[model samples]
Target: MNPTTTALRAGCSRGLIELRQSLTNAGELLNHVLWPVLMLVTLFFVRDVSFGQSGFLLGTLVLPSILGMNAAMALVTMSHLLTVDREDGTLLRAKSTPNGMVTYLVGKIISVSGGLVVDLAIFLVPGLFIISGLAVGSVGSWLALTGLLALGLAATLPIGAVLGSVFTSARDQGLLTLPILGMIAISGVFYPVTSMPEWVQWTAQVFPIYWMGLGMRAALLPDSAVGVEIGESWRHVETVCALGAWAVLGLLLAPVVLRRMARRESGSAVARRRERAQRRVS
Candidate 1:
């Protein structure tokens, strides 16, 4: 077998192992379950409340949007994980092995993307029951949901990897949460973008998160619910174009950024970081 092919296979195996570990470990399992559980509790409270005069249950509108937002959260997850692994010398060790960098990236993608799918299921399965407005019985709804999810992931994950490569420390990575939260606030995760100020709507439209949420809403909400969306339409073409642009840009940039970051990894650098981390902990 070609060396790269062997590395890819090994990477897939590593990803599976990591995925299994994440699911089985008590703390990691709790982490996986926690957010969805919280979201469900929130949904339980508002499932009956109607949104403004739109006559749509707030929970129904929010459910699919939450799904889309979570898909976009793939960016933060990938970024944070890469930063943590680099800090722990995992990247350095990979640099020492033949074809290791390729395998390492593939493994990380598998682990992150696999974990995300599980997280989405955790939220989506029960959400389907708790929310009422979704077009769950239709094949077209499911197909649209699946396509938006794929596009959302493609649009965010590579950019996340690039961001991860740029940040040198966990502290800096944590700071990223603030901007992400701000984006979510403006991205119509909890409400309609059309309800926000005009400038806010335009700003939200610039990010993949807004397009993702809009795509989900288009997929799951009843056609009548379109009354609350911007221009009172699903705008599928714009959603695809916006997400496609991000996907292309991220795919183009991630490899170059990752390669630069990987080249900077060394035994001495990793050792220094470890020492500093230990000192901080102590």
Candidate 2:
């Protein structure tokens, strides 16, 4: 089989494993799933509120923001799991195969993409029908939303790979949750970016989540929180340009980070640290 096909097959295998595991645990009511449900209910009660149909604007905005949040969580979860896999010798065994990175990344894309689809269906679909109603009327808008979600996933996957390669254990994984949640809060996932200060908004723009939220807002709303008109020449061009830039940067950086991480696997320092972590956990 070709390298791509081999990678793809490995990816499929990993995705199936993750999907079955996720579905099993997803049955429980946890903050990740529960919060969105609560928010959707809250929004439904106040559907008539608007700043120029900002109810519809907010409805559309929230979905992509949540998708961005999903992307962040996916990155963190995958990083931790991948690190554990590496420490436990799973990655080394996998690397013996052809195109390890291709296989690993493809698998992650499938798993994360699948999870996000369910997340959107459960969170956004109801919000659109219950709150925004017919605001999302056009096929173009739906296409735009899908494109933005894909960009969000593409941009974040590299970050996850980088994290996986860099972090060596579960403690580092716990530490990641703070920064990730902080970024999500500042990215305007739950609130409007406009409500945030100018400097804060600028800072948020450094991450893909903000751009994803902005692009989603543009696609979903007639009016934009970022002060640009969607589908306008400049706006449309900038959207394509920004997403493309992030995707390219991620692809370039991921391999470099992974190679460095692979080197650490054999070092005495890592082994000592891993042993200490195991002792602490035990």
* TM-score of each predicted structure versus truth: 0.97, 0.80
Global fold similarity of model 2 (TM-score): 0.80
Q: Tell me the lDDT of model 2 at 56.
A: 46
lDDT of 2 by residue, 61-132 (tens): 465566556654667756776777777666665665678866776777787677667766777767777654
In candidate 2, position 262 carries an lDDT of 64
lDDT score of residue 218 within candidate 1: 92
Q: Which residue runs does candidate 1 get wrong by more than 4 Å?
A: none
lDDT of 1 by residue, 1-282 (tens): 999999999999999999999999999999899998998898889899988998888899999899899999999998998999899988888888999988988898888889988988999999888887688889999999999988998999999999999887887887899999999999988878888999999999999999999999999988999999999999999999999999999999998998899899988888898898889899
Question: Which residue runs does candidate 2 get wrong by more than 4 Å?
Answer: 25-32, 38-64, 223-234, 266-274
| Candidate 1: clashing pairs of residues | none
